[model samples]
Target: MPVESSALPPADTVSVAGLIDNIRGRDHRQSRLAWEIYTDIERIHALTLDRPPELDTRVFDHFANSSALLGAVNHIDKSHADALVNEALALVHRIPLTGLCLYDGIINQRQFQLLVSVTDLVDGWPSAPDVDKQIAKDLQDNGPGSTRRLRDLTKRAIFAHDPDAVRRRAEQARARRTATVRPRPDGMAHLGITAPAEDAQLAMAAVEALIAAAICPHDPRKKNARRSDAAMNTLQGIPLVCQCGREDCTATPRGAGMSDLHARIVVHVICQDGTLGGDSHDGGGPDEGGPQDSPDGGPGSEDPGGDGSDDGPGDDGPSDDGPHNSGPECGGDAERPGFLDGYGVITADHVRAIAQRPDAIIRPLNPKPGQALPTHQPGDPYRFSAALDTFIRARDGYCVFAGCNKPAWACDLDHVDEFNHDDPAAGGQTSAGGANAKCRYHHLIKTFGEWLDDQFVDADGRTRVTVTSPDGVTIEGRGHTNEMLFPALRTVRFQKPPPRGPTTPAADDPNNGSGPRRTRTRTADKHARRRRERELNRRFRELHDFGPPPDDRR
Candidate 1:
């Protein structure tokens, strides 16, 4: 209103010198806007459910059909919008936590989904309400962590509340296990199997074991190529140490006795000399290692990079969760705790526990590349030798497609230049470095479909694949390195968690980390709740110890 106000600069540049660090009122305004959005969503859900019970199936059908119409008008995909509407209805009817989180306006949609997914894990617990509240608080405590960390916290909560439930869930999951195959475009099909967590983890470990013994540093194959070769051999029922260390299990060695399972699975364990004594390390939860450079690079210190391992269910696999061989580390120990997975990150301790199994196969992973791969038949340059096969398999840890982490060991090895039998000159060189690790379906796509791909290897031997789609779009993918994530595992140990510091936006999106700011009110409420719980438990224990008023007869 003032004349001077009209002459002011744009808001972003108008801050006073000392005011740059201050919080703006607009931050709180965002929270208010979120609250309004939640309210509107709730209203839409109510309108659907409030339909007369007498309308029965017709009303239900309307709820489903009308959502598509609404989504269409809004230019949102119908199925996804319908799903959102249904989820909102469920929140109002089933979970009250959403309302609480919405009221605070600090929890964004992703956080909400994470909270809901974890809370649902407690569904069968005897004390669902208490578990829900506890889980909700734990989610809030972290503010917004990585999606992986959030999932790990959910695991921590589950185990802390009910170990028995975990055991039961694992058993139930195994009973529901299955291995299925689905066809993809072209002649390719997806192969997926779900077994016990221990079995699954051990099976994956065996492949890595083979790759380590065969792959060499100068070998041309990428990480994915090596993995693909290893996986195929493993699937052929190679004499792997089956049973995952479970002594009493009647489960026979997979592919055993039959020619199918006769492939020899030899394990080799090699590690540098090291002494174990002092506790100078700690572990992060299942998904993270500490961010700092370890002063001593202690036994448990993170090794920086390792490829991922398949440890859970996929699109059509069995129950994902199971009783682990190892328990989760307490809190945020940074002594490089956690195991590296197929995705090259370590956060779960069960990986080690699985490795500890008596029947688990162990093998050496030479950091420097091993012997030169073989090229059989001096007269012919087309037959890839076993050593060359191993080289390529080890180089590629999984499929070479961008973001498609299907274990390379279980994929197909195809020649990049397309092998030729009729014309010797036209035939591609049969060498480990010239191979690619591609999944069955993806391979078919490259071979017969309108897809064209080319590869280039860096001087350091990391291979890159550029894929051109039927459309004009082109995307590039780089293969994993040959580094091991846990090289000092023989003496590794869990240490204390790293210190907490500032919170940062987890993702690059602007929508992230814009939730309501923390205040003294949160801390005070947390402390008060602790006091109340202690008082309640104390009173209950006192009552329990009284033994029914001493029994008048006694």
Candidate 2:
């Protein structure tokens, strides 16, 4: 009923490039090919595991060397390779081929199949040769005849299998996996539960427990009781109570008392709508047996909620004993004598001139009463001002640490010399001198860690600062400073200027005619005379026909 392959067109007749092009075009075709190869490897892995105890190493070696099998199939990209390898390895470990053949004595069939699949996927037939050699060497060193008894034991363990025993052992493993407890937002603990499959009853129980643990309030019609108590009643005889106090307080309250109290406190503190706990007034109970009256009558009151006038004093206004001052009125010479006296009233235009005037001197608002002025003043006030300006400009660079990019303007000017007398020698530099801009954190690290040993010295031999590492390494000196720490005014690489236009040649014979081309003078005139004397000896030898020089001399 079916057509014979001999009657059909040969696959070789189709171009290999065309075949590849066809495969590339269809996503499903590529995926199917990859999965087919993966499934084959999985089957091969299982057969290797099911073999007799003594045959595992030989079987595994064959799988590992099967590079031809792996490379023959396509879809060897990162994602496909990873997924296939992972799935195969998972099965191998589950059956535990590696454990039985190497370290652990027990093995599961499922685990063996998985491992074989992974090994085949990773190492194809061509790659298998190297794996074979390695395995053979390991067997030679650690097989039955090895000097180490433990090595032999390990070898036996890697090949052994026990399907039922493994399954039983996995029970404890599953428990350990599920034992982890995650913390709830309300500070309660919850155990994670994972089953072979989802069970509705179990899931519902977990949900019910969570709901019970949560402090949901009861309906107002039900006297605003705890939801835990209501949930307990819903689940009859399922106790939900404070679980505290002396022996006899077993009456379940539906939810945990502690959780309820905590939830109540949180609601009271964080409720933006101002609805939880109670109304704004103290005496507003839930059931008062009458329609509640609004605080400002039935919605349309002329009182405008409190008081109508915007500026007028209300219930919360200042009392007589408050900071109310009834003082004399302003603008009168008699009532407030010196209100306008001695006050200079200058117009806005005059401000600039007053500020720029050479004779302008502004006194300090709160100068020390008896403090004496400095006896030895350094230059004029303007010179001092200029020095300050220069100091600010020079120190405009950011915190001077490699990779630290803090701006200098944003930092504090730290004194290298401490101002306090008690720790005079503490900060390194002398008193009343030396300061550098540093951020608050860096300043603390420098000061407390006593890292002033690290410093940058300027050309004048003045120590700028030092930042020493905790490891006792000193980072100091001038040119070695990190440029990243300082603000870069310009980059270091040089740029060449653009070429100029060609100059026009001067017109020939237009003026006094072309001048003679200048010749370069030689500096070896004396040397030339010495060279001529040397050449005379050679000329004389040629004229006299002197005998040939001795062989050794020649």
Candidate 3:
């Protein structure tokens, strides 16, 4: 299907395309208005070029740093204001055809940004001089798809033009890999790492591997929480413990400070009947619908009193002493890709590598609710009970505040309505429906910044939350729903499990990571089930089921 006209945000909605949609709200009028702003932007760009040569400022620097100037004029934030000026500088100076199209609001700012990035991507290639024309021509002919699709096209074209440039860049990028820390408001900090493309992909693969290997479907850790933990485990060499007997898992060392940082990081992976879809069960095929055919054996299949064993194939689940992926036979799916929470999808090889972890552990959690229970729990006071917290975490996925990606595990679970301590009749009861996970930062924002958050169950059975800023801007998002724990793995067929080779980590698995690769020689899952069963048995024997001993401790 084509990119519909309305699929993209209106030019003025996020761009400098001003008030054009105000008149009739017709498609043509919106386009005209977008083009009007685009043309004005071009005019400004041209005017900037004619500035006296005596002035030292380059047109590029002037445009790039003109966010304040643009913001002052457009009445938007500095970031959005920069979009207007940068769009003009990018399109008019490089690809005029794209500039013209934007002038008429043919696409949104995101599409324009995609084109800009593609142009920059090919700029250093051997065919750099002519690459712009070729790129514009391709967009003119093929029509842009998603940003990723556009990036792929750009890379392919550049690679075809000069494959050596691609090789050279790949090698050169290795030297650029480094980690940095950026501090945020309210004592929060962001850690950024840039690795070579392969390592970067594998790193994300590790995160997905950790999530899949460590987190069960019923655990309340939102994807962001899982992702944060996964990244920490991968880079920090942390060891994940299996809490099989536990029903809920929270990020550990809650109040630990910098001084308490240890050489070993601990990860907690929870598994339940719903988290590990036992291989090739009666689910018919991967795509087969209905809870009766759930990938992880549906809601009620969980063992309330077991170590996630006897749930069938993955009973052993994950173990710290388990063998790794990338050996003679890739641990699981070597071709299928799993999702990297908060980022994108990862390759099967990456998935396998994570599963092969010597520090990975798996445990079982109680079954998740298949549908909404009563809005509030009876007789519960203070915060949510463990059951209600688990239910809410599985549903919301992350902090309820807007644009905040803090994981639910790291957040303070709060009631939407104030919990009544003084008057039970006047105060809201602690229940799944009224509970939300908000990090301390966002919690403050909601309490003092006049931000509001409301949650409701959507038609698809997903619990959706609407967050409104003090300025009254509201946006909606959803979290973990009644979907399978591993949707990508469930929907996409993996390779047929190969004959077991070594019961140890691959000497050179892209590092303890893994997936189920499919084959036609036999039912893809037949091998998958057998392989999982074998892994579970081997690892389960070594599991303390209680806990592991530390270097200096009992």
Candidate 4:
């Protein structure tokens, strides 16, 4: 179909529009290539430096801006661009030089302002999987305060200054969050001690002592077992009493201590027995052989007592019998009968309630009250004493970690090696031999994480501890050693390097300074200037299109 000449725009106008479209396309392609090159730079840099390939968006931005200078070189010859990149790489090879360059690259006046805005609003850049990339994209598209904002002003400022500083700040924030505190309505309040995170641990020795004290008074083997049981039950607010007594003696009320101790003892005893039956269940009874006969031909009967025969004392006299019958049972009515039918029976279920309460104090039933303490067996006393001494020294009268001040005496001694049935390598003799102490929280970490591998062997053959932080720092002794145990306690300062000068081309060089190098620089500067002009024009056009300025001509 032939188009009318009047309907179409002028040829010159069409050509201009085409030229504009071509320029836009070229701009888009160049921008895309620049971004790709930036990504490549980052990947190569991270790999070469042995750092994590994924960097914070803020770090990426820093590198991107620095590489923008390279974009300027793109306008010149390829050889010049290559030289600039090579120079940059060479500088980066020196560790301190790289740090300084990255710092300079990220912290110019414009970058500083942007970093502050981002950090102030966003809280901080996230370090999770793919998060930094997302954050960078959002910052570019929507600017600060957007949904994808990554950091607050403070964090941004810190990051722009030094990435390590930002990292340290983040770690401190996390530690503050996890630090121990009193329970509050909103959550744990960041007050009180900051001991290692842990569950409350109980000492077996303390538990045993408590249990013994509680139950010793009511022990059936005691002098006045019935009276003591009644007294204990009264103290403990329980109904437990000696059924051996007819009075149903309810004098002493049971305290938490008495009830708990009794229950624990009962359970312990029953567990020892396997079946719930008491010591009586283990047989110590007479043999199955019939009773021995008397030498006097007195009633030769199966029963220990004679069957109405009077070969010596007219059926009532004692008879001379074999060794088995020598004990008075050979004569009439000399055998003692089994326990009476009406004796009381103690059941395991009766004590179940008291056994499970955490606050309840347990006691042993048979320990001698007010009696001299038993001498601890040789190896046993030394082991326990050594462990206790180590705990006291390492903890230094309080929790070793910063901000935690829990008294060492109040803390429980935790075994570094958990006593578990699974993982035979961690069980029995091997684990027992490897035991080291920690408070409840550190114990949990060791049992549940990589802290199990963190150990220290002391001069006395006792193993201490080592803690590896998330940042790959290894802290030893829990502050027991001379060195600063926490990164927070240490200070890091950086010194800026001197500025670089322009490079001079050698006379022998094939390409003169005006060759590829000069061309690249000139082209880059031209592109930058063009971009600036375009941006300014766009802004001005928008302003003019929106409204005319107010007339101030008086």
Candidate 5:
């Protein structure tokens, strides 16, 4: 049934059903409007269909199409309108299925944009139609669910159908890596580095470590402020000093020792053993035969960060067991791709290239029927074991919260069920099955808010999660787990560790004793600021605005 605007009550008075109806109505309208715009552009394009197919002619045609809509759109610049028109043309002509999906209300504007952007390189290939069809089917059957998931799906489709194009794009992107600085509205500037994912991750980790070591926890500066200060100090090759007033602060760097900045970059790349030798498909086909050399010949290229040596402190130098073929043990074919922790899916050839690096450490994760993995249960150690921690991080891949893409390596390992400190025997066990990676913000919400999350292994061996909001609304997802991308993860499972012997709680433990008191509660500060804002808003509303300055009024 068509939605009627008259049927929906006012925002405050609308029922749940009414609100849902109103949302769907707006969605349908948006889709219809997009279709109409696409058709309009098509008509404009038809007017010059007979023109020569030269690059300059195409540019001229685009300008003509955009010029026709100069004064048509309201409250938008001509340049912005022109970009929109060009995008519409690309959608309808290049990736036809995505445009059709948008017209059918299967995806929203953001989702459409992501699909177009990710598939931009693949759309010119012969296999582009297959990629488009598969994406449309995935979107229609399962729904993109979130923009993050949509991007992953689109990239995966492009890669699966056209690996060469994906590799070409990656090489081109790698060549364009550069650092930039931009001015902001406030008296601040934005510093950006367009480096490779691994390089950026390492640089970020080093900066954060410096910031933490430079000041005591009691420093008054906010996190962002401290980050800026630390970054500037490091860039200028200066030693960072403690900002705390106390002269005896432990975090204070005594000498130029703070100038020595280094981070142990451990990029967790999960993949099958076969992937390390190059893609399985590379054995056969014309273009796909054998491992292709990287743009800089091999992994030994003069890449600034790719020195192929793990010299940083506390770095684990590969596994003891070493590289072993885990195909049969992991229950997957040989063509599976690899997943970089912060980066998304990478090709099998790319994985092999990483493996060829002298610093690369390849460890096979083989799951035997009764193999014992590390686990923490009950009592003394509340932390998951190092091996178990690594497994869980690789499994979940990112924050389990819907739509969040924060990589697992940077996230905290959160227990799905809260652990009981007072009585450890009765609490949630810290094991692979019960633990997941959650970014700090979402972890705090799950701990304090009325949100509830339940995780369970599906019959197909994939981990599934369902999150319920305070209002009782629920959403189910695969928790953005990489087990889907790497099938080997699915085969690995840890038996719940045996309960540990109970031990007396330490006197200094925060949960056992009264924790260090805060100067002011977060809730109190929030309420105070909001109350002042309300008062100011009321005062501003009561005072009438003068029409303009005296000269302008004339």
Candidate 6:
């Protein structure tokens, strides 16, 4: 029998046309604002256009650097202001098609900026115009879903139109690989190594393997902290030893000796959990923790716990020494991409190639369909289980905050619905379905700033998020899942465990259906400070008559 009309849920009455119009209207306003900013920058540029380099005049010095003046006006860094001017001018002049798209509201400012960046190398190439036209047409036809997709589309257009230019740029970039150290605050420094994509991934994999082998799972240090220490140890010929202090710790490296001199290296190459057909566990080989030569080429051999055994079946055969598989069987979903952890997405071919390396070790992380991953129910600890934590990090590749792209691994797993510390059984279980990756800043804002974040799984199983600002402006986003990179994750589902006890009475609960206590949000504080600063600056401008008549040193 058909359900009664009133009993049924109300149909979605939102108008698609109205939404599109609203978006277009906003885009147009933003485009106009960008143009206004560009004009202001141009006027500033004109002031110093033909100034003499040898001029010692105070007036000339003050007007010479447009970026400095603009920075002062905007209360921003000079370098940042310079970059903004350059970007604005480039959009208007170099890539006019993209600029037109911006004007027509076909693409937003961020997308335009991304296009400008990708097309930078091919600016003077022969097919640059064609590339621009293609990008504009593609965006007009089917706009990218996200900035990541926009970047992917822009890069594809560049590769298609200017293949030679792309090749030349890649070659040039490869030749320029180097390592550098920059001093940081508080007696710290940043060490960066620029290398080929494959090399970087491999190096990271090696470091990860060292961490895995040297430290126990119960180690006090976080993965990131351990990674830093492991990298340092590897670089300095020191042992990546366990600091857990447990006498029976399974980690091999106890102290600096023969074993310490020769630590095993196991490079983990993640692929799809199983065969392309998804029916069998015929992917990923056994972990091969083979003894690797020390940084000083010193030779030492000891079984680092891994005895090469057939952990599973795949196209590759069991090899006691190294991987024998040429590559993964290519067809259907087998060609799905994989990510390089700290790096960006890599193709299936790259994944297969890395897996087939002589020194590589394949560790399969299988995602079983319809299986319930670890979840915190009532009476259980509030913290998410290790398995659930890993899944959440992988599922939400980055922070769920609207514009933040901070990697999920580095973010705090925040409960979208405030977890009831007073009464856990009432609601907000520490489960995969209830949690979202939020960077510290956004987390703090969500807690203190009257910001509301709602996360739900749609009918199609996509994780949808809506973040509402204090003023009621809502921004919609979706989790950047690993399903694209690791196809096996597509089948994985999170079923929120049911509450273990009787629900708490709405009246009795301290939250009373409301979120955290509202406070003067940091964002509001920053805006208020900026407004006061701007007002003061304006008043000073009126009183001082243009900054002490421009440094009177002649």
Indicate which candidate wins on TM-score.
Answer: 5
Q: Provide the clashing-pair count of each candidate structure.
A: 54, 31, 32, 35, 0, 0
TM per candidate comes to 0.40, 0.18, 0.37, 0.18, 0.69, 0.48
- For candidate 2, the 10 contiguous residues with the lowest summed lDDT are 265-274
Off by over 4 Å in 2: 1-394, 422-433, 453-456, 460-464, 479-554
Off by over 4 Å in 5: 1-32, 51-59, 67-75, 100-106, 145-147, 181-191, 244-248, 254-265, 278-336, 349-359, 367-374, 377-383, 417-433, 457-461, 496-554
Global CA lDDT of candidate 5, please? 0.58
Q: List the global CA lDDT of all models.
A: 0.42, 0.30, 0.43, 0.29, 0.58, 0.54
**What value does the lDDT take at residue 351 in candidate 3?**
36
lDDT of prediction 4? 0.29
Which segments of candidate 1 are over 4 A away from where they belong?
1-38, 54-66, 76-79, 90-95, 102-106, 122-126, 156-172, 237-554
Please provide, for model 2 over 76-109, each residue's C-alpha lDDT reduced to its tens digit, 9 standing for 90 to 100: 6545544554454433333222322322211122
lDDT of 3 by residue, 1-554 (tens): 89998898776666222333333246535544665666677676566554454465554555644566667777889778777776666665655656554444444556667766656645434476455555555554333433443454455455435545555554566567788999999998899988633345435545555555555665556777767766776556665443334646543322212212221122212122221233322222111111011123222232221111011211121111111111011122223332222222223333334434543332212222122222223342443333334334433334566445554444556665444344333333455555566666766665556555565544434454556554544443333321222322212111121233343432553433555432322422333343344345335433633121112211
Give me the overall lDDT of model 1.
0.42
Off by over 4 Å in 6: 1-101, 104-111, 119-193, 197-331, 356-361, 367-370, 376-381, 422-425, 458-461, 478-490, 499-554
Model 3: residue 32 alpha-carbon error in angstroms: 4.7
By lDDT, who's the top model here? 5
In model 5, which range of ten residues has the least summed lDDT?
A: 305-314
Q: Per-residue lDDT for 1-554 in model 6, tens only?
A: 88888884455754555565678678767965665566567666756665455556565453447778778888998678767777765665567766766666556777777777878868766787888888776665444445665664565566556656656676677689889999999999999999766567456756766776779987889889998998888787788778888888898762223343223332223344332223333332111122233222110111121111111111111112221111122234544444443344444445555655564544222223234444532244465544445455556656677556665545667766665555555445676667766766777787678667676654445665667676656554443454433434544444466567765443444656786644445544543443354345435434652111121211
Ranking by lDDT: 5, 6, 3, 1, 2, 4
TM-score of 4: 0.18
- Residue 259 of model 5 has an lDDT of 32
